[model samples]
Target chain A: MLYDVFISPFAEFEFMRRALIGSFALTIGAAPIGVFLMLRRMSLVGDAMAHAILPGAAVGYLISGLSLAAMTAGGLVAGCLVAILAGVVTRNTLLREDASLASFYIISLAAGVTLVSLRGSNIDLLHVLFGSVLALDDDTLLLLAWIATITLLVLAVMFRPLLLECVDPGFLRSVSRGGTVTHLVFLCLVVVNLVGGFHAMGTLLAVGMLMLPAIAARFWCAGVGPMIAAAAFIGALASISGLLVSYHAGLATGPTIILSAGVLYIFSLLVGPHGGLVRQWAPGRHLEA
Target chain B: MTFALRFSDLTLGYERHPAIHHLTGEVPAGDLLAVCGPNGAGKSTLLKGIVGILSPLDGTIERVGVGPREIAYLPQAADIDRSFPVTVYELVSTGLLREAGLFGRIGRGERTRIEDAIAAVGLTGFEGRSIGTLSGGQMQRMLFARLLLQDSPVILLDEPFTAIDDKTTSDLLGLIGRWHSEKRTVIAVLHDFEVVRKHFPRTLLLAREKVAWDATQNALNGENLLKARRMVEAFDTAAHACERAA
Candidate 1:
């Protein structure tokens, strides 16, 4: 029975396998970007960027009649551009960064909803926000694989500048030309990952997945390289565990994966090495002598 | 001897408000310069301006021959943005980014230099320790190690003595003196007039809108000294009034 429900089910149907593959692909793609986003304090932007894509997704559907990959692509490009433009406006104008982000995101969210409403009755706007993991198709799996590969490559190539800029913007500026431009590019890369993640993980889960592992891994160490590795491991593990839980319990895979990540975050909060509650609460572990 | 820093009519500030007006100064080779001022007198602002932290408003302020490759800056103790997850070793190693003299991999010679720099700052055993796990003095030492790795001919320090114990202060000043003996120029924005007289041969007093005074304590003993005293008293009175209002 266990073989039939768990092991043999993979052999019987393609959708179940596709669902797992799609989610894994998405995780691999978005995990590293998620880690860095948390470091940059750009996690909220990641979440907002994910939501920012919904109206674009709806608009793409109305134009293309529900080609998931094409619609998602449209949504991603629109969201990324909006994020960049908002950042630019914030820097150029008198408004503070977060305030500008709030202004742009609110308007984008409103516009996206209006676009979705105008698109037609066939499309469900809720599906864009929550994501439809069960509806994973071959094309989406391929797209996920492609995005994951691109993200890995981009990070590898620009690792030095990106990491340096994140850690020491002034230092990078002192060394490199137009350090601000380099920072913007990094932000854009993070936005791309979030938009790509929206395909299988959905907006909320996608953003949650980005931050949870990184924050949890802060309990492990204070080194950037190690922190990122730990975060990626936690993310991959949470994805697998979440998928398994959903497979067994008939729950929403995206939300379940998010819950798994949430568990890790909580664990890190209480048991993390840097500032864990357990360490603080232990008899001999308190900071003061 | 090369001019370590030569500022010609440099005007610098934040946003639109100018702090150090179109002023000029030169710190020749191997000299220890004490930049003095009352509260809000733009001493720190002048140091930052020299290091290109704040953009120059008008006129030319050149570091003479020093490019980005040749200057090390030790920021104010309170001004450091320290929310990073880095170790002392990591912080020092960043200094070698300019010093390594190459790319891709850091060579053995650079690594040896980094170790020596860390040792010089009395943080030999703490190189592997996380920066967040440091005391205020240790953090300053770690920053000094970073500056050492930069190995620049010119070092600009902004109020590096605040909150430090006197022992550490002397230890650090001794190190700065050693650099001067090695023919490296050190320019520091300082508050201690006593130390200024003892260690620094030349001192420049600033009052935001003016140079205020630029000479030794002997010059300060004359009319220049009385004017500087007035400036200092003005600053004290302003602080007391603000406190009462608060």
Candidate 2:
């Protein structure tokens, strides 16, 4: 039963193998970015950015139909534009970040949906919206791997300043010029990962791989470092399990993967160590001196 | 004598409406100065200008010897997001950001310095504890520890004792006294007049403009204090923008 559930799928199907590899790449590249978004209180902003990239992806599709490179470039540009627009509006105008992001993302989503529908049929729209993990070519796989590598490397380089910027921006400003640079670089990283995820699992569910795993890990860990590691592990685990479930049950791959992450999140919320419902509800835990 | 900070006809504010209007002063190097003023008197704004967080609307703030990295600033506790996930040690280690930077290695000596700063702030054995678990006093102590690690020549404190207990305040004041003895230039925005009169020898009194900048005795005089209050109270919130002379 176990062999049939997991091993046979990978051993028999080339598409399943490719899908698993692609999901792993997405997990490594995108999940840690999600952790930062959560820490910065920009989880929803990450989601908004995913939608904001759809118009870009659609534009990419319009320019070169189903061309991975073109779609990725388009998504990158649109995502960055929204990120910068939201940042500018928040800083200069009376509108707060959430309000500004909401305004931009909704407009971007509408534009994206409109653009995709303009040229493509319903099947093409579904492909753009739901992603085709099974249909990923070698180039797409390579792109995912490169994004994961760059995201991890850039994040590693910017780790210290990024932490300071997140925790105490005023102190960072007092000490170095890296604060603003760190912020811009972080936004770029977010956009890069979102574009990558958009290719792997559609615009709508791309953020799920990023956010859900990080949030679930947050329930289990106290420190940022631990939380990041735990989130990556959860993301990887969810990807594998989600792939297995999709293979055996004949389910949609993208939603199943995100739903796998969602299940972990729910489980962690109930039973994981840090601030879990069980921990909170346990007798005498709070009263301890 | 070189001035650590020199503010010449400085105007600082939000939206071109000066919160501090045409203020001018010099802080002598190594002097401990207290910035005292009524509410909205722009004490915090002056500090922000010195720390380079806020640019002057007009004129200049000249620092003779100190560069941006050589001045350590402590903002109000309210401005910090205490819920952030960081250990006390990790937060304190960030004081070395100017030295180690983004990818710089923290050698044994640097690590020891961090440990010493944590110890100096009375946060020994809290090396592994998350910052979110710290009490208000502990958080303030951790901030002081970080400042100690900064080891800068100029220190700016914004209401460092506002919310902490008296014991923590006194403990931190001792650290300040040590900085004074070491001849570090220290400027603090203080609301407690009694604390200022007692510890700080110099004071700059403000009321959207310079009211007094002298010894604490002279700056805190009853008449000057009353005048500052009235000036702050009577200032028009809906006043027209001042035209630049060009």
Model 2 per-residue lDDT at B60: 91
Q: For residues A175-207, could you state the per-residue lDDT of candidate 1 as single tens digits?
A: 455456756676676666666667777766678
lDDT of each: 0.72, 0.87
Query: Which ranges in model 2 have alpha carbons more than 4 Å from their true place?
Result: A113-123, A283-289, B234-238, B241-246
User: Model 1 over residues B1-246: C-alpha lDDT tens digits?
Assistant: 677677776667655555666677677877788887767777777766766756677666666668743578776743333676767777778787654422457778878888998898888888778777799988888777877777788888888888888987898888888888888888888888788888888877776645444556753455554565565322222222112110
Best by lDDT: 2
lDDT of 2 by residue, B5-43 (tens): 888889998877788889877899999999999889998
Question: Looking at model 2 chain B, which ten-residue stretch has the lowest summed lDDT?
Answer: B232-241
After TM-score superposition, what is the CA distance of residue B80 in candidate 2 from its true location, in Å? 2.4
Top-scoring candidate (TM-score): 2
How would you class the docking of model 1? Answer: acceptable
Lowest-lDDT window of 10 residues in candidate 2 chain A? A280-289
Which residues of candidate 1, in runs, are more than 4 Å off?
A: A1-6, A89-95, A117-122, A164-178, A268-274, A283-289, B68-70, B77-83, B99-103, B209-215, B229-246
